[model samples]
Target: GRRALVAGVADDNGFGFAIAKALAAAGASVCVATWPPALNIFLNLIERGKIDDSRRLADGSLMTFERIYPLDATFDTLADAPEEIRTNKRYAERGDFSIEGLATQLVADFGEKPLDIVVHSLANGPEVKKPLLEVSRHGYLAAVSASAYSMVSMVQRLGPLLRPGGSFSSLTYMASERVIPGYGGGMSSAKAALESDTRTLAFEAGRKFGARVNVISAGPYASRAASAIGI
Candidate 1:
């Protein structure tokens, strides 16, 4: 009825973009939440016509987004962020895209209206090429933060922002269930945590908010972020 907020779109070829376009074609307004540093580049890509939205659908129509927001989930509150993280090389360049920032922005713009769908398509594993035993604490935690805990944080913050019977989906991997060689550096563990939390959230959030929470365990696909991890 309203819009689906698809998060973690780095580019048009990613799963998030595909999902957004599909939702738009189905007559749902689509808004995207992209990593802040890449927000400008994403906007530029759309502006310069680098991303084509003119592919004929099965019913012969075009699709496009209604809005795009910058989103980062590390800090629930702007004040909780460390100065170093706020002023970090890449993060500093992007403005407020934190989870709280996005929530605040949505409330300011939509006035406490609930969303219909929320998609969580974000993940990261810094030392993905390394084995779990070889992974450092920072790398492991980073994977958990970006991949696993973000889902929990999303449900915590966005659950209230979702309408009754709204659907929430997050992307996981088969790695959560089965080990894949070279899928290392705690990536599997991150996915495991993600899957575990998905079920937990399904129960908790379903009871509390009358919403549906599920996860799609996606097969490996070639993506910029995936390629960076050598997947």
Candidate 2:
């Protein structure tokens, strides 16, 4: 069976969870990576069987993740992580949660060319409540860093590990091009960057690694990320 890694799955209410379940239902062995801070909470939810009902597929089989790793897409490598982040209680015990670290860990656990699909379903904007004009430089860059450039970093780090012709996908929003009130904190700009980068990555990754890169701009959905935008 093909192996797939779906990153950014912090809860059951988002596209990440749905994608992971769909991949599993399609006969792929799915694995997921959650943010370090929410890793334990997510695991607890799973351990307590809180999402078992949601995990059930149309055919009655329950979705299962082959493995769950801790990941923080903000850093491409562990060395890029700040001391405070490295020492945080939630991250301290977790070995290398950076994108590169995840790639290395995947290689160690599953051998070379271990993945057939890589899904980037995560985004974050700390100053989402602030208007774009009011968003600070730090906040704007952080939004682009976590929400947009992370996909580039992921492909750079994980692309080589994908089997030939493997698929790499990320989620975007209409706010990238259309003006959506309350979608602030440079998130719209980030999504725009994500969409642009996807097109460029499609050509680059396809040639270099025989992989396909794509993005999906989903309509409004009451996921946690959307709710953060006052949806």
Q: By lDDT, who's the top model here?
A: 2
Question: What's the C-alpha lDDT at position 161 in model 2?
Answer: 98
Runs with alpha carbons beyond 4 Å of true place in candidate 1 = 53-62, 88-95
Per-model TM-score, in order, reads: 0.92, 0.98
Tens-place lDDT digits, model 2, residues 131-198: 89899999999999999999999999999999977999999989899898788999999999999999
Best by TM-score: 2
For candidate 2, the 10 contiguous residues with the lowest summed lDDT are: 221-230
Model 2 scores what on Cα lDDT?
0.94
lDDT of 2 at 173: 88
lDDT of each: 0.81, 0.94
Error of 2 at 51 (Å): 0.7
Show the colliding residue pairs in model 1: 72-97
Task: Compute the lDDT for candidate 1.
Answer: 0.81
